[model samples]
Target: MTGGRLRPGTIFGIGLNYADTIREMGRETPTTPYLFPKLTSSVIGDGEAIVIDTEITSRVDWESELAVVIGETARDVPAAEALGIVRGYTVAQDVSARDLQEADGQWVRGKGLDTFCPLGPEVVPAADVPDPQQLAVRTWLNGERVQEGTTKDMVFTVAELIAYLSSFFTLRPGDVILTGTPSGCGDFRTPRMALKPGDVLVSEVEGIGRLTNPVVAKT
Candidate 1:
């Protein structure tokens, strides 16, 4: 059932979807979901190495999130029926280059680096995930438990996201939507956690499986 790996399609990502994360950063709740794109070239499957070019970015960080996979062609989907087009759920790490993200003011370059979007170990069918909003998500950096939260904290629900996104354009099968990460991302940590060579990052969602990746120095 792990056939959840994203295929030929655009993967959309959302920012500030988690309410606690917004509050933790002292930001206002978003009236609509803030969106971004993790270019398809940035995708890596489970166990793939997340290569980082230290020269280009000294602040590569982890943002574990839940990813929803599209099962059918959809357009102008309604929130009440959004989940109908979903194929399954998976895990993804929104690996970010914080310096570039904050300095550039736009997220494309900061979030679209090759291997920046670490995708699934497997996709769990939507039928199996009765309530995506109720799932628990966690992130582990190396052996340390760095983040733990539940989807219940999301400011925008998954169904709402689907409906909102499809309203703009058609969402095809295999397209993915990264819901958002929790408040424990590396950039917000006390000492500021960052990804470096030899670090293993594990992202997990309750219904979906975990994605485990190792950090490597970009040659």
Candidate 2:
């Protein structure tokens, strides 16, 4: 199903969940953690093209992430029981407008742009993924592998993140929590390599399948 078909719910994301990514960004790892929400409008289906708005943003970067979909409502759930509520997992590309993301001092506008959140070829049932923490997640631009890592590198496990989030608000079915991205984002490159029209991005989670999409100019 397309993101538009999703019911109204919070789209949460964790930032800097990978240690290598934190070091590469030249920032100290967070003591408490960082999280953000994406507008539902930002969600797009796999194989769909992301429209690059060159006039407003020229530095667009791609982030591959594993997304957790909540199956049941959870409030103040304990970490040990957090995974029980996970419905499934899916692949997501957190497309970013670097110039706007850094200049705005906040992620809302830069992250909320339409089609900025590309999710799913299909959601793999949680049962299918026996251990989310043991899976490998990677991203490819065109045919070149740009990012490669495993969930084993995550500083915070999915269960821990769910428990932490539940302490703040209730998580209901259809709610999506983007775990985070690894090192090798386009923005972190020496000269910086941004996505251009025609570039294809594919993110894959070991058992969750791959999400593929091409970049297109917004006309």
Local accuracy by lDDT, each model: 0.90, 0.88
Clashing residue pairs in candidate 2 are none
lDDT of 2 at 48: 82
The regions of model 1 sitting more than 4 angstroms off are: 1-5
Q: Count the backbone clashes (under 3 Å) in each candidate.
A: 0, 0
- What's model 1's TM-score? 0.96
Please give each candidate's TM-score.
Answer: 0.96, 0.96
User: How well does candidate 1 match the true structure, expressed as C-alpha RMSD?
Assistant: 1.6
Error of 1 at 125 (Å): 0.8
Tell me the TM-score of model 2.
0.96
Candidate with top lDDT is 1
User: Per-residue error at 138 for model 1, in Å?
Assistant: 0.3
